[model samples]
Target: MTSTSTSPSAKFLTAQRSELLSRRESYLADMARSTATALELTEDGANQDMADEDGFGEGDTLNVERDRLLVVASEAKERVAEIDAALARVDAGTYGACEACGKPIPEARLEVVPEATLCVNCKTGASLRRK
Candidate 1:
């Protein structure tokens, strides 16, 4: 895997990668807090027997919200992983090359989708296939 990072795309990818990593860390921390709260809710209900029905409903809602947040956190983690892989490609001298066609992914495309692994043509093809 040889890189062809000759233009501004490499710099943009680097910046995007760093930003994604930071965002990922933040998301993970937030998710951890939510998880801790969820666990505490279970503990409180089990041993203490929270008698407030409204409060129990609220807790249930929070659990649902926590589940949704966990999904979002997982997605952020995946995005971070992709960005890390892209950075690794940069180190391997293969950054910005389309995985599908082995062509250079345009800087504009990279700007729009920093974690893109395929060029527009390949991506379009993939979308069409899904349809």
Candidate 2:
């Protein structure tokens, strides 16, 4: 995609891309660690063969912890995916624009969420729909 040299949005996105990439890497590392921890916890929970009911509570706690870890990993994975998509938009010269309405995303929103592809209105609508 051809990008105009004078476009402030393009420049801003280019400047922010490196930071987003760094964040994406961090998220990926976190995901790996969380997933590994979750898997280990799950295995440990499953392998507990204690016949005593006293140990059952501990096993349940382990399972709950494993689930929490898995949720963290899942959220990390989603963040990575969002970062990747944002990077793609940067490459396509469409960064800082809302994907839903084709409007320019506000600088404030971009600063808060560099991977955001929707403006506040669109995002709010989508959030409400999800609820």
Candidate 3:
């Protein structure tokens, strides 16, 4: 059934959409900050002269920080992509359904993880298979 103003499903989907959009914006901001920090660290490392021992240590530290920031940025980007996919599912009227089992995902679980594509049982099974 399609979402209508009077339907509880419609309200749930609307709430999910709002939460997903908020999370997407937060992740995007995090990615931007992390990327900027990484870039700055890279630039700082490049500007340091590596001929001296202290320069070498400082540069190494900067490189390590940059790597960490890059990882953070990458994770944020991945989360943003997931959130985008969730938004797409919302638009397609499949937001509350499990992709793997075609069952309705619990509201509690959805409240905790708005981007979840699989229900708990399927998710557990998938995780077990991966291991």
Tens-place lDDT per residue, model 1, 30-78, is 6677567657656665544366655766667666766676676567567
- Comparing 1 with 2 on TM-score, the higher-scoring candidate is 2
Lowest lDDT sum, 10 consecutive residues, model 3, at 1-10
TM-score of candidate 3 to 2 decimals: 0.88
Q: Give the distance in Å from residue 12's predicted Cα in candidate 2 to where it truly belongs.
A: 1.0
Least well predicted 10-residue stretch by lDDT in candidate 2: 3-12
The most accurate candidate by lDDT is: 3
| Candidate 2 error regions (>4 Å) | 1-7, 50-54
Could you give me the TM-score of model 2 versus the true structure?
A: 0.85
Model 1 RMSD, rounded to 1 decimal? 4.4
> lDDT for each of the candidates?
0.70, 0.84, 0.87
Q: Model 3, 1-131: lDDT tens per residue? A: 56543222877888989999999999999999999999988877877854455688888888889999999999999999999999998887778788888888888899899999898999999999999
lDDT, model 2, position 77: 95
State in Å the error of residue 111, model 2: 1.4
Error of 2 at 120 (Å): 0.7
